[model samples]
Target: MNYDIFNGDADGIIALLQLRLANPINGELVTGVKRDIQLLEQVQVRPEDRLTVLDISMEKNSAALINALDVGADVFYADHHRCGDITQHQNLQAHIDLDANTCTALIIDQLLEGQFHLWAITAAYGDNLIAKADELATKVNLTKVQAEQLKELGTLINYNGYGSNISDLHFHPADLYRALLNYPNPFDVIIDTNSPFNLLQTAYQQDMDNALAIETKHTSACLSVFELPNTAWARRISGVYGNFLANQQTDSAHAVLTDNNDGTYTVSLRAPLDNKQGAGDVCSQFETGGGRAAAAGINALAKSDLPNFIKSVESHYLV
Candidate 1:
């Protein structure tokens, strides 16, 4: 009973695809929408069955994972997320790489000696580490046009993971996987013109339209706050909007705040690119948020504290 559990995003599915292309395996794919992070628990791996976990972090499900390992199933784990120590187990072989440039597909590429480098590029691009992916793509001799195509598909797939739930996404990730299965490379997927990629691009542009309509507060010298309407497009597109606004107005710290389903607001904060002087520390002042120097995300803040949240943002990032 061989079983595969993965992230269900392009990185997750194509990470499995890379492994399969390099070394064929017989297994059942256990996957769903992106929020289904606790996927490994559902798998029934016997003592004799082999399990391969891709992209998902073990720490996110430590108790269940240790239980499975105790049951005598062999596990091959490949991921690039933040996870604790890999316990010594006769049946477990860990291929975890935490480098920010690393993705599960890139880890599989290393195991396969670049046999599926193109797919690795796509995964990396979709993860928004474009510089890292582009550097790797040059080694494989990807033309400028081909590299851009891969980047587009990568962004499209990543955007597909934005929603709080699967229904909020433009298309189900599994449905995107089926369409991708027809093409070995993204170049083939993009050139079809009538491909699902087109549908995704259209939706992405529409989201951008909604994002462009947001109004900003300019509450402080370092922080600019844009309170957004409560809509699927708003929730799905806020982070992207934050990134875009920060880039456009390079000097000011930008925060994209969206009204959450719970009547609270979700905030995305970005640090200035020049100084790497960041404000995740400030976000932690409120509930439901944590991140590092350059980028950080906050889940939900009460509407009542919206003024206080703005004041905190002002004091933290303002010059």
Candidate 2:
């Protein structure tokens, strides 16, 4: 059996989409809400099975990966997130780049010689590699209007992946990936009246409108913090909303805290756009936290530690 295990975000879904579009495959799709990164554990691999994993941190899935390898499952892994020392195994092919500017879809783009360059660019935009995506779009001579369309499509697809669970999302990541498979070109997704793009666009706007209406919980010269109620819209918009806040104030770090309803909070932190460092390191201090430097998150932070989290982020960036 062949299993495709990927993060349910725009980067992961688009990465697999480009791969399968270039070399079509029939495989079991394994994915969940964007935060659910330990997907390999769900697949009971046989010695003859093959696994394609993308856009998830190797550090978080290391044990499952070793189990698959131990069982003789050949695995191909690609990601840009923090990865500890990787295992050297004959059954594993890993493509990981920790450069803040690159994402897994772009890695696949290089491997495929840009056969699906447009989709790769969209993934870059979705992954918040805005300047990089713009550079690629310009090199390809995509018009400004076309570039904006791709950006919106990428942003909406990315926003759909932010829920705490599949139930919180408008479309399950697997369903979103399958919905997008028909459009090998990102432009086709934009042009199709009935595509997921239309639904996502509408949904994104609704959520963003609601999020924008909420006032900040804390604000200072170097940092700003906001708290969101425990609603599906809040869960769906938190990450993208952090991106929005970062863009609005490029020099200040921002935090979006969503109530998790268990006396804990789900935290999305973004370092200053001008200095994208320390976010992953700061989040990693918590048990359920980890991510890239520019963008990081904590799955469930105790409500009592909210003050400490704020102080940690402030101290890291304020100096």
Estimate every model's Cα lDDT from 0 to 1. 0.74, 0.93
- What's the TM-score of every candidate structure? 0.80, 0.98
Please state the error at residue 100 of candidate 2 in Å.
Answer: 0.6
| Most lDDT-accurate candidate | 2
* Cα-based lDDT at residue 149, candidate 1: 86
Worst 10 residues of 1 by lDDT: 272-281
Give all candidate RMSDs, comma-separated.
3.7, 0.9
The 10-residue segment with the lowest total lDDT in model 2: 164-173
Q: Give candidate 2 misplaced runs (Cα > 4 Å).
A: none
Off by over 4 Å in 1: 24-26, 217-226, 239-255, 266-319
Clash counts for the predictions, in order:
0, 0
Which residue pairs does candidate 2 place in steric collision? none
lDDT of 1 by residue, 10-86 (tens): 67877887777666676777776554657888986577778888877666656667877998888888877545677
lDDT of 2 by residue, 1-319 (tens): 9999999889999999999999898999999998998898899889989999999999999999999999999999999988898978999999999888899999999999999999999999998888899999999999999999999988998999998878888898889999899998889999999889888998999999999999999998888999999999999999999988998998999999999999999999998988888888999999899999889999999999999999999889886
